[model samples]
Target: MTRQKWTTEEQEVWLEERKPAFLIANQKRCAAKSFYPDLVKEFRDKWPVPPVTQAEIDDAGSVELATRVKRDKYDKRTSSWYPNNTRTLSAHGGANEILKIKSQPQPRKLQAWQAYHALTYESKWKPHVNKAWTTYKEEWLAEHPKEKPEKTRLEVMVEFMKGKFNEENDDMKKRCEEYRNPEMQAVLNPAKAKPQAAINEAFQSAINLLPRTLATIGESLVKQTGWNITILAGGPMPDTDGTILTYLSHSGKTKEGDSFDKFLGKKDYDDHVLCPFEKFLHASFSMDGEDDKEKEMDDEEWKKQNSESEENENQTENVDQTKNGNKKSVGGLSEYEKSKAKNIAQLKLVMENLNENYPFPEDLVPKPALKKPAAKKEKKEIQQPVERRASMRNKGGDKDRYVM
Candidate 1:
């Protein structure tokens, strides 16, 4: 009988459905034949061929003989003898090759929702899907190197959700604006709007000016007098326009303790202890006469005038003595002169104390040597009184004096 060719539909049905069923049934038969010798013989008998003749056996080469001698050789086994047998169907050539070609897996086609569900819920398909996606991304990037790759499945889903939320929010805002009732409109508008407060421009100007003015004055004082000034902390005060203030302080030590906390001020700190300390520093350290040049010039002019007056007075006294016999004592110095003299004396004392305590730089100060026994004895005598005076001074006074 002549074999009939399969139509397209029949070929598809056989490949998609009937082929797998046939494979399973043939496998079962093969397994059964392994246990039953008669079943095996029956399958071999169905595809019978003539036995090898004596001449053909003699002509067989060594390799062919060795291959034929193997017990599980395809031709020798009943399992692979029949066409529909699982082993025959799985073989590498002929009908087996056709089956393998037909059985090549079809590319799965899924709807968007189905694909999402499969990716999310189907663990078995995840590896295959990930591998396919990676391959597709690489190919797409190769084709269009400049464009960014597509968003991931999860990212796309998240963006979809965000878009839905924004749409809902916009609808809500529109509904709020379109509400007809007056109370509802007022409620919505009031709830959405920010509140504003009334501002006093004049008060704000003054508030802002206060700290700036104070800072300017403090800076000028520091530059003129070389006093170290520090603005420790500052901030604006609520409900007081734009008023900002800072805590003023210095880094010196005082009799009580640190001068920083003791001399703290909100404004006009230059008028306090800083001014006096600066004056004392300038006076004590004014060796080049740079700080008090004007004062010195005034003093010289006053001294010249006073000396001329004294000379005239002396001439008058001499004339009186020559004319009368007795003269009155010269009047005392003026209050300004007395005060100036006192200040000069105080400045000299301060300088002397500073020299004794801190002294000048080591390079400028002379150091005594005590290499010999005689010099050592003299050095001890000199330092003994100085150390004793220092100890007595430390014990007598408030030792926490300002450092600068």
Candidate 2:
């Protein structure tokens, strides 16, 4: 029977699933097969072949055999299978290549490569690096060129232990391997461990002093001056241990403590203790003054001037009040003098008014106490209310009351 030709769709499907090794296997008997002519010729040159069937070529066993051969050859390169120069691969240097294969120390029961493969599938690690085992292994080999390429982290650790202390039958080959783990190196080296305690103590001391220093400074400034200074405490304390570690960290000082939640519940009761004397010295000069004696004299003179001016103002005010009292005081008129003045005014006014027409009211009659106007003047009404008028009518009330 004549074979049916594959349709375009069937040809596309064949290409998609085609394997070079399978195609090469089939070319011997299936001369009409169009796929992989170059691959068939290449495989035939590399491996001797008797007549092979298409069915046998498609079988997975053939592909498995090809893969195993390739893997075994690759394994040989990374080992001492050939001379060092002859075995050199293009990508991996020969010495390093062999090291990569054997570097991973084996578990007692399993080889290092087997341990790596098993660990890759282990439930804990599979999530981080799942099917990309080849890429991960390549990258690990690149970083740890000095490390045994075949060792797992755990296996490397064991070998590390044996090399360090196992001197009786020390394996020189194992000890030559270098593992460059910075963290591990630090732990292994004794010199790195000594200063760590002092560093830790200093850090603890600084953290503990942060709150106490702030509170003390705040309380001292308040007691010295009446002005209530708002000390913002969210930042490092100013001049803590007399060190200028930083300037103020808090924003403008605020009355609301809720704004500085980090610095809550701190206070101090001590009298103002100055930040250490070293803080005041800007190189050689003191902040308060270079010459203490001169500064003291200046301060004393300033105080004396303020005191004298205040006393002078008080004395001048008292003298002005005394002069005002003398002006307000007037002697009382005599009763006899007043009566004689009234009689003389009555006779003169009667003689002068003999030609006047009508009699005036009895209360309207002139008295010596009444004064006559020298010329015509405009009369103004007194504006005081009745209560004010009544108060003003009393004699002692005028002297006791002061007007602005």
* RMSD from true fold, candidate 1: 41.3
Per-residue lDDT of candidate 1, residues 144-239 (tens digit): 998876767565444443443354555543453343333444354444223433234444444433333334444444443333344333333233
lDDT of 2 by residue, 1-404 (tens): 84553324643343334444344544454523543354334434544343444554465368666555554443343222112323336455542242111243542443333333333224334443433445556788799967756746555444433433344233432222221233332343444444855765666455444322333343334333322233322211122322212111121122342212122322210001011111222222212332221111233342343234335443432222222221111111111122334544554554344325224334335445323443233112222332344542222211111000
Off by over 4 Å in 2: 1-151, 168-209, 212-272, 275-404
lDDT (CA) for every model shown? Answer: 0.39, 0.33
- Ten-residue region with minimum lDDT total, candidate 2: 268-277
Per-residue error (Å), model 2, residue 328: 60
Would you list the clashing residue pairs of candidate 1?
Answer: none
Stretches > 4 Å off in candidate 1: 1-230, 249-258, 261-404
How close is every model to the real structure, measured as TM-score? 0.14, 0.14
The global Cα lDDT (0 to 1) of model 1 is: 0.39
